[model samples]
Target: MASKRKTSALLAVGLVAGIVSPIAPLAVAQQLTTQSTAVTHTCELVKPWGLLGAKNQGTIVSPETVVVRYPATVAPGEVFTAYVQPGAAAMRTTDGRQAGLLSYDIAFPSNSTNLAANYNGGGSGYSIPGNGPALVDRVAANGQLATEGPFARISGGATAFHGANSRNGDAVDRWKAGMQVASNTTFRFPEVALKMRAPVSLANGSTITTALKAAGQSGDSDDPTRNTIQGAEEGGWGTERTNYYFCGSSANAGSLSTTTVNSSLPRYLAKTTTRMVTSDTLLPLAARTTNLTAEVSSTEELMSNIRPGGMNFTIRHKATGQLLATVPNVTVGANGQATASYTFPTLSNGSYRDEYEVTATYAGRVDDIESSTSEPVTVSVGYNEVNANVVLTSTNGALSGGTMPVTLRAAFALPAGKPAPAGLAIQLFRNDLPHGAPITIPTGTTTANYTFPTDTLTQAQETRTYRYRAEVVPVISGVDRFVGGSATPVAAIVVGSSPGSPLPEGGQGSVALEGFFRAPQLVWDWLTGSIGQAGAFSSGFAEN
Candidate 1:
């Protein structure tokens, strides 16, 4: 990885006075009377060639910038003081060997700026030769120099050196230097201040913002804004160049400072709204016999906020809070809205409430702001009893085997305390008895008299008899109870060679006939438990 190194200098009063005494004791002492200088240096590793393994080469092509500043003033030759402190190496490997060379580009902006020729009196002090160049060997490593650049430019009041290097064979690059100036001219000493900017590698981009938007949020200018700029690998150099410029401002200058980062714009996704449109209640005399319907409406505002392909709609029973049904990801129109309907059947009669919720998920984040739920819709159903009456309308009940003309009429009356039945079911029995083999009756507006065939009886039998009876069973809405009330009176007929003849007589005939009539009463008693006495005809019959 690429890295950055910084060095700061803090000088003691004793060292400052010692370095400036040789120029002219009185002049240096006067210039250094009350002056303080602070120097800061920053080194940044850079790769202009974009070559791989360049970082591991142990030869760092870093541009070092320095900012020099003086907190106090001094008279010429009065021991103008400055100091340099060495910095740590810029790179380290697994083996703990420090690697790389330090190269620097120093710019003074004008030639008027000056440094002492031999501040240390040519002993252990840095020297700038008048003909050749200022060169200082590395003290920490072994082969590093203080000044390596040949690019020299004089402008304004300073001279600019384009590059420099240190040759420390110990694999560690350390820059160590310091200076105290004594001016030859009779002038006041100016304070020296240094400011530097280093470019560090930010290979991976940074995160800026995260947000949520409610459903139906339009493309209004109020929407959040987001914008980003690619980082630079190599740009302008020098101590004054800012790092990570934003809108032309150097608000972010330091390396890897999270506090300086902020969002450029906001992002919103998946906006939606839901509501209950209609609800109704039903009351049937039987449990699990009622049907209910609920209508719901949904609308979406933003298109891109919607998940790719579709969205999901679900209905839940609020009372039990159980999910009734789930409709998976449905595609919406460009208008960003859609509507659907649902019906529930065979629902048990009781108080029930249900709610509907819609969700939209996109790009790994569920946009909950756009999600919505409908108000609870409650439905109550009560027991509703209605009378179903079947009447044998025809007086001629005698018949032959093939296509006998028989008419059975049926009608219904609304229950005493309930509304009219929405619909009815009618069944016909074979032996004119209740609860026997059934024949389905078709629904109709008015009382229907259906004509069909009756079972054929053998002519060889001495006694041929047929009976017809009709029942009026009460059917209640939203309830499971089947009520039997005022049935049509039983009708009987005796079939013999003569149309009108006295009832045929035989031994034990009266006993056998009574047993046959009592059979139906026994069956009705077992089904309903209404019959009380053995051979009781009136007990099973409806009173009304």
Candidate 2:
């Protein structure tokens, strides 16, 4: 519990990059704010699960009008607050769950400003009206609190979790409420105030807005819920980059209700430039990695102390415009640069060997510094080379009439200390034609084991000669990052005939060809085997 308190405090003051932090502790920020703006917005709430225990999702159960007071004119490089008056009459859940911990999401009107989202804003919500003291839930008092996040953001701001607020999916958070909600006349969720900062310079009339959030929303895998609010999502994000909490205990998470306050301010614009560079232009999809860096500069504005804030690196296909991957919140250093190492995923539209572009969008701590996108850098992602060899372990030196064993080995020319390829698919071929569908190479002890079956021979003058090889093939719905390899085929010769006709009369010279010594033969129906011998060939004395 003590640890959670510390974390709550850290969130308000988390952003440590250039410019003054909008999410800073209120006492430190209020001193610099001298102006304020008020905006009224009407919000709608739709919940399907009512008292009837039925699911009527997307049905608007309540409509709310919220008044927000914000800093219309802010002191450049100073932090301020957007105060929201909380108002809700009756909020209940029919899912037999008393699990509703509420919070709100703040979206600024422009990229010229920034927002800071703290879970509880270092204070608990007022379940009752402001006349009451700060309300702490009795359930949460026992340590079973609702889940809130100090999740990282791409622009260095922080936010709480908002997603499939349901019982079906266990996301990174359980979205449990700290306690059951009860109301006499009206009730309010916690943390009605949101923090925001303005650029060092800006224009006037810039506005900010927020919305009431319940559980579940649009935009996640096409999800729609009663809590869905159009154009009012918590935007700044990272893949656990701004993560500030672990999951909390819960029975079944009740719908969370949130109200984020908003304010607006503007100043003159400053010109900013962003530049990007990568370590490599040609990267193999098998090992697609590069050190990507972006630098932001401003001639008139100061660009230093970008510490906690950073840029977002987006790698996408140039031709198809399919977004591949995004490396978010790369911290900008005091040197005005942010660096990160990124790997490319397989291209979906084209072959694995496709061209990609990397772009960096800067999100600085100071709003006046101006957010900019770096010029894209192009890189090629392709497959690595794979070489193959077929080793013939055949007793039939000539493809005249005997069984032969062989193994088709496909080897990848990887660097030293790199692990060899296994589980790669290959297809056997006879005379440049596929023998069958692709087959996977089994993972051998420290190597790949690729083996083939042998064909037996009969004493009937069966004459056949064929060249067999192996070629790399698709890995059955998997993205194969190895170039197709065609193995050098082995020439198999098998010639058999009736004993009298096959012996070639009058060949006086006898050769003890490949005959293992001291093994008694047992020949039945032309299939001969010694006492403890296999795959033995003899000419002088017909033996196996």
Candidate 3:
């Protein structure tokens, strides 16, 4: 009976590539060459029950079958013994009785290698002793036996379960009731593959779990009891299990339960959207002092159920809708996308408008959306033209020769309706002292007249007195031109010398020029022009 050639090779230690196939292998080598050699198998049903309960009674029952002898040359496309039921059957009885075969095997050896058998069964409740089936039926007499029959069938038909604690104490509900297999029949044993390795490669906040050990097979084995073998889990099985399931009790039966698995296997993970391409109305305008930028993008789908957490922005002012600022969360990586920036503050002259919106929240709602508004930014605040003044006329309270010249007149007030500043420049100062610089006033003039000269007079310059000042210029620009005050200080001017009619002890020619011309008037006209032609008409320049 050799039709079963099941060869599954998934050597995925890092998985490169693979494929292989060959079904029914000669109907299991002609059903082990025609059956019966003396079938006398007996062992009713021992039940002390314990796949999950009553081995010591913590309540975990389900795997309990005891027949002991049934493989004595049973041919017919022979591929002997392999049953792994349990997808729900009163969860396999516990209080309702039925729980006792934690292990089984009787001559079990038909993993097909081209039909051949020989065995005798020597026992004591059997624990191994040439096991069973083996009586020399070595093929090759007429050489024609390839019936091809069971190698793997049972498509689905073994529903028996119950595992929430019948006393195996939650090993993921006892490996989800032993890998819930509903079929099995294969020969040419020696084919087990399952691999997964990790050194470090799952970045972006990661998590991983892998544990599957059981390779090849032989005798004294260190721990190998899948009794029937099963594997395939990522999120759904028994009491919410995930992986691993094997059984062959007593030998300290343990190592092969491990649940809680998820390497991502459910499919369907789409749905995504993000925006803010560009449109705060193209934001810009305010004497052109700009720096307002905005950008946002998202689409989703990177695995691990579309994970992306971070992005929340809100800024408004579309015309008094007024929110103005709020940017929180913002992290978006794993290729989802995110970017934001805003700066626009110096626009205070005239005409302005704005509006913007962008939203993208995943796994919690608000998928992806964007908006923009802007256009109406006009500004201009500027105008300057200043003029100031202070001027006076009339001065001289008492000055007996030393210095004099204090005249003044200045005025300006342009910059209200403009007009009144044509080539203007009038700045004068003396007793009001602002000395040196500004005294132009000449183009059709706005009135600018000033004078001052000095030379050290005594008597405190006849008791002191003088004043004058003026300034204008700053039209329509940055602004800063001033001057106004001081133009009324006039007093000080008196000089005398008369009285001299008897200088006669040493007198000569008539002397009647009072005080002798006070020694001034160029010394009395230089002593009357040297006294020569002054004989007849000169009676000492009298009377006036």
What is the clash count for each candidate, in the order shown? 47, 31, 60
- lDDT of prediction 3: 0.27
lDDT of 3 at 201: 23
| Per-residue alpha-carbon lDDT of candidate 3 for residues 1-544, written as tens digits (9 for 90 to 100) | 0111222221111111241111122222211111111111111111222243222211121232221212222211112322111111112222222211122222112222222122222212111113332111121111112122111211011101111111222234332321131112111111111111111122222322211111122112122222222221112222332222232222211111111112221111123454433333333332222222233332222222223445555555544556656555655554544455645444345523223333333332221112222232321212221444444333332222433332333444333343334445555554466655765444334344454332232332111222234444332222212223433322222121222322212222222344334435323433443211222212223222
User: Which ranges of candidate 1 are over 4 A from the true structure?
Assistant: 1-309, 313-328, 334-336, 339-508, 511-544
Q: For residues 136-211, write the lDDT of model 1, one tens digit per residue.
A: 2211111112232111111111111111221111111111111111112111111122211111111123311111
lDDT against the true structure, each candidate: 0.27, 0.39, 0.27
> Model 2, 172-250: lDDT tens per residue?
2222222223322234333444554544544343333333332222223122222222211100121111111112211
Model 2 vs. true fold: TM: 0.28
> 336, model 3: CA deviation in Å?
5.4
Q: How high is each candidate's TM-score?
A: 0.22, 0.28, 0.18
Give the runs in model 2 whose Cα sits over 4 Å from its true position: 1-273, 277-293, 297-301, 304-316, 319-354, 360-375, 378-396, 399-427, 432-451, 456-465, 472-484, 493-544
For all predictions, the C-alpha RMSD in Å is: 30.8, 19.3, 33.0
Sum up the clashes in candidate 3: 60
